[model samples]
Structures are given as structure tokens and as C-alpha cells.
Target: MQSLSYVFPVLIMLAIGGYYVWMMQKRGQAIQNIGPAMHAFFARTGFRYDHMPPEPIEAHVHLAMQEANNWAPGNRETRYVRMYQGLPINHRQAYLYDDAGMSMSCNWSAPLPGPPRIPFHVADRSLASLGKAMREAFSNTTRCWSAKHPHAVQTGIPQIDGRFLVFGRDPNAVRWLFQQNPQLVGALLQCVEVDLWVDDRDAVFADPMQKNMNAAMGGMTGQMALGFDVAKRMELSIPVHDRMSDLLLMSVRAACQ
Candidate 1:
């Protein structure tokens, strides 16, 4: 829909983007059109989180593990967080992960200012990589101690490395946080990458289904269970940036370094 002028200059970009869309369609073609499907996914997450005014466009994520917990699994932990665009610069992000030792979820709100201006080439391919990381992190659950908790993670990674990427609600602020703190060097070494935002509300909503599946398929119900961070569940919810500092303190410290 870009001006036809974007036609030639962005042709290659468009081709690659088209292929990405094609692949997305091939992989998980929504049963519905883009608008409805997109709205449905995030709207569902929003509804699940807080049935409040303005109907939040919720995006769910599973950072897969806690960055502070050392997320110590096997040699490599995988995870899928989120990828979004067109959100207000002040869009708020809230991590579903609690203050407990248990597994946690990542929740964020980023409604595009005017419309979805994200390029499929960038967001699409980036999403694919994030998905891969998430699956890897989840697949290797047996390797980490945190995996024993009754939750899953869906928050920002805040690393700059090639492997793991998490988008800060405010990239400038997060980048500044990194510069202000240096103790996070080790965490940053882990490649805490910050990325653009994307809606993934279904990730949070699917918690019940996943727990049920695990119980039915893996027979691990007797163990701890997973959960989504319902508004009802939030005994304490702070501004999104504060939440990020607490969760990404170490890496943020490094980025500041």
C-alpha cells in the first residue's frame, strides 16, 4: 500500500517481504483475514489480561526463562518473546513473570500510533528467529532449575547479541539503562538483544491449553503448572519501565556500562 513510488525502490524489499508473508501463510495461515486475525489475537490477550476501558491490545510472550535466574538450562536455551510495530512511543510493557522463583510471563501493550507500519521483511524474519529461540528454550526445559517453577516467561531479553533479542518499550531508555550500569556485563555477554515490538497475545492465552496438554500428554500435572498473568492475578502491577529494570537489571546494568 506504500505509494507506487515505493514500487521500484522497495521492490527487492517487497519481494523478500512477500516471500516472508508467503512462508507465514504457509506455516500458520490465519483462518481469517489479516485485520480480524491480528485484532483477534491481541484483543484476546487484552481481554484476558484486563477487561478494562479502551480494550488493551495485549501481546503475550514467553521469554522462555528468567534472564536474572541465570536461565541456566543446557548449553543453549531457546525462547520466543515478541515482535510488534505501529505502537505509540509511550506504549507500556508489563511482564507476566512474578517476583517469585517460579516461571513468569511477559505482557506488553503497543498499539501502533496510526497503523501497522512494520515491514514484513524485518518483523517477519525477526519473528521467525525469535520463535526458533523460544522453542529451543522450551524444548530444553529439563536443563534449567527455573523450569521447575509453575510459570513461563514472556518478557524482554534486552541483549544486543546476534542470538537473543528483546525489544525495550523505549529502546532509547533501555539503551541508556545499559550505559548507566556495568555490572550487567555478564548478562549482556549472554546476548540480551532488544528488538521492535510485535503482538503475541495468544502466547499468554494459550497457557491453560499448554498446561492441559502437558498434563494429558506428558503426565506432568502432579508437578507445578503454568499460568497466565491475569489482571486478577496482579496483586502488584507497576509502570512497565520499572518492571523492566527489575527483570533486566543485570543486563541493563551492562548496557549502561
Candidate 2:
């Protein structure tokens, strides 16, 4: 009876441990199912799923996570990658990466002929999530640029809304761009956000301890080292893949011109 008591307790502990391991594996498998939905999204958008360029940004991000020891178990197993283009208009590169926690869509445009000498960023008024100070700085610094359209559309080609916040080292270039082509500004405003920086840095915040910051910084650094420009990063929440594609197409078209 005494031996049985010890044996029974050991068996119970073993059973509990086994159950915990099983639950973990099941959770991991559930994450694996996210890949198919991602695949379907690619098919719908006419992009080639899992057909990314060698050493793509997503891959680099994964490598960065590994280097920083920030990787979670099964994190690597859940990543999906795809390549796309703005067909019939722009041939520049575009791609998508969907991971366990975040999804990103990226597109590149041909370097503008004598592109504006300074970097600029524009964000939607409805979506500005930054602090009051940042908002005030952007407003004080960026003028309200307006433009008119030649087409007789239903809306009379609305003026560039006052909601956008544009910041750049060269306000004249931004003003000139808007003055020269209201249509271009209109196209850009349609995008969720735009970043036109000509530097090696990314939109990622500098704090290394923030969520995904290490991976973001390391990935951006790696891309710059590889001689590729990291132009913009638009973080997509749930079910934003289709919208991402449309906005990417519009932004690339407008910026390239």
C-alpha cells in the first residue's frame, strides 16, 4: 500500500505534464492554420505566395529576432511571405509578410527623377495615434496644401483635406508637388500613410525593449546594409490585407510620378 501511494502520485504528475505539453502543441498547430488564410489572400490579390525574393525583409526580421534572442517558440513556423506588383501600371517590387502577431505590406517605387532632397511623412488625421506634442509639431511645420482636379468627377475632385499631416526637411518640395499635381496629393491621401525618407533608418521606434522593436531595428539595419531602401512600413490590423494591397498600389503610383 505504501509503494502504491508513491507510484500513484508519480503517475499523476506525469499525466499532468503530458497534458500540458499536448496543449502547447495544439496551440502551435492552431497558429499553423493562419498560413492558409494568408495563402488565400495572396491568391485573391494575384500575388505569388511563398515566392519572395531571396533574403526578404521578413526573413531578415526572423534572423534579427533570433540574433537578439527574442524569438518565441513556434514563432518561425508561423510566418507567411508573398510577392506582388502593381500590374499594368507600376512594375516596382511589393511584398507581404504575415506572422503570428503582426502583418505588414510593403511596396517600392522607382527612385523619383531628382526625388525631393529630403524625407517626408504623411499620416491620416483620423488615424494619428501619437501624442499632442507630435501632432502640434507636425501641424505647425506642415502647411495645408491644396489642389484642384481637371476631371469632372461626382465629388468635384475634393481638395486635399486639411486632415493630413506632412513633415519634411524641404516644405517647398512638398508644396511644389501638391501645387503642381493635386491629383498626386489626392492619390497619396488615399493611402493609409506615406513615408518618403532617403535614409538608412526605419519608422520603428528606437527603444530596444518595446514590442517588436528589436526585430524591427535589426531588420531595417540589415536591409540598409544590403543596399535596399526601406521606404515605408504600414502596420495592418486584422483583416486589412486587401486594403493594404490597394493602398500600396496607389502610394507607389503617386510617389513614383
Candidate 3:
């Protein structure tokens, strides 16, 4: 009976050890899935890979987790990377691709969507989402796209779209701002191609570094970096649509910084 009593404790210890091993391995795999997403996003934003901190910013990661359940992960058009790094010092900020082809500033947050006037709140979540996305996209710029009325459409012709609006750095600055954000240039023309490709795979984009790298390569590779390497010059313009193409480029410039 004494021997059996010792055996029972041994068995319990063995079970605990096995469970720990299994959990550790699973966590390792989860970390793997997020890597390519990071590489794609930040890489596209022109962040030097050398700048990759030992860990993600803690606050950014926390904010990301708060919105982790959000409907739209990040504007699909921006191909932004979402990461929360610890960096040893633990300064956290959500890393995202602004609609411009550049990195979102460290203090960036998706703004709250509310009408500029009282009693004129946004109704359709889709329009509100678009406005919040544009706020992220054009934070550093002078012009931004927002709904003019609760009845406006964000896409199509802004004027005819009633509630939809446009983003600008002022009349003279549009072209100059357009020159800054390259991803917006792609959003205007190539987003459909990207969307089609992303849809074909049904994979979620979680990393910015790898996304940029794959996109810079012509999107030949899967979101997870399966078995391909796209050429570095993957840029292509979408079909022109009533000057909408230029507007797309403008978004890229705004986001690119």
C-alpha cells in the first residue's frame, strides 16, 4: 500500500509535466502564425528590419487586444501590420498600416466615430468604420475622408454619395500628399487584386512586415509566406475610374509616412 501511494503521486507529477509541454508547444505555434503578418506589414511601411525590437510594444499590443474583436481588423486597403511589442521597456502601441503606405505614428488610435454636429450621429456601422479608418489613414495629413451627412456614401462619387466625403491636405496639397503615401496608390487600383487574392486564401492579415514584403513582390506569395517570393517591384495601377485612381494614390501617400 505504501508503494502504491508513492506511485499515485508519481503519476500525478508525470501528468502535470506532460500538460506543460503540450501547452508550451502550442504557444510556440501560435507565435509562428503571427510572424509573417508582422514582417509583411512593417516591411512595407519602410521600417528597417533592424529596427524590429526584441519584443512588441506592450501598450500597443494591449490596445490591439482590446480591438482584437473588432469587425474590420485594419483597413484591408492599407495592408497595415498589427503587432503589440514588449521591447523590454514595455511601451506598447498598435502597429498599423495607415491608408498611406507608411507606418502609423506611435500614439495612433482608431478615433471614435461621431458626427461633427450634435444630434447628427452616425448610423450605419460601415460608414462609421470607414471614417475611423480614414482617421487612422490621414492622421498626419491636412485632408481626410469623412461622411458629410448621416446619409452619405463612402464609396462612389463623394458628392453624389450624399453622406460620403473626401480627404485632402487642402486643394494645393492633394498632389503633394499623394506623393507621400504609396500604399494609397495601390489601394486606389490594386486593392481589388489584393482583395481577390486574400479572399482566395481566406487568411487573416495580422503582421505588417511580411505583408509589405509579399505585396512588394507582386502578391505571388500566400499571406503566411508559404512557397513563393514576389519580385520587389510588385506595384501596379488599377483601372482609372473618374479620377478615383488619383484619390487612391492620395490615400497611399497619407498612409506611407
Better of 1 and 3 by TM-score: 3
The digit string of per-residue lDDT tens for model 2 on 5-121 reads: 999999999999999998767545534433444334334443332334354344444443343344343323222333335222122222223453332223332233334343345
The TM-score, computed over Cα atoms with residue i paired to residue i, of candidate 2 is 0.36
Model 2 misplacement above 4 A: 1-28, 31-35, 46-120, 124-162, 168-173, 179-239
The superposed Cα distance between candidate 1 and the true structure at residue 70, in angstroms, equals: 36
* Candidate 3 per-residue lDDT over residues 84-129, each given as its tens digit: 2211111113435655654432111111122211111111233345
**Reference-based TM-score of each model:** 0.21, 0.36, 0.24
For all predictions, the C-alpha RMSD in Å is 22.2, 13.7, 16.1
Per-residue lDDT tens digits for candidate 1, residues 1-257, read 66887787789898999998886564343222333433443343222222133433423221111232243343332222222221121222222333443343232233222322211100112334546578758875311111111222222333433333333344454444444544443433422222223222111111211222233322454332312222211212222222223323232223222
Model 3 residue 121 lDDT?
12
Model 1 TM-score relative to the real fold: 0.21
Candidate 1's displacement at residue 9, Å, is 78
- Candidate models: Cα lDDT each: 0.31, 0.39, 0.32
Which candidate gets the maximum lDDT versus the true structure?
Answer: 2
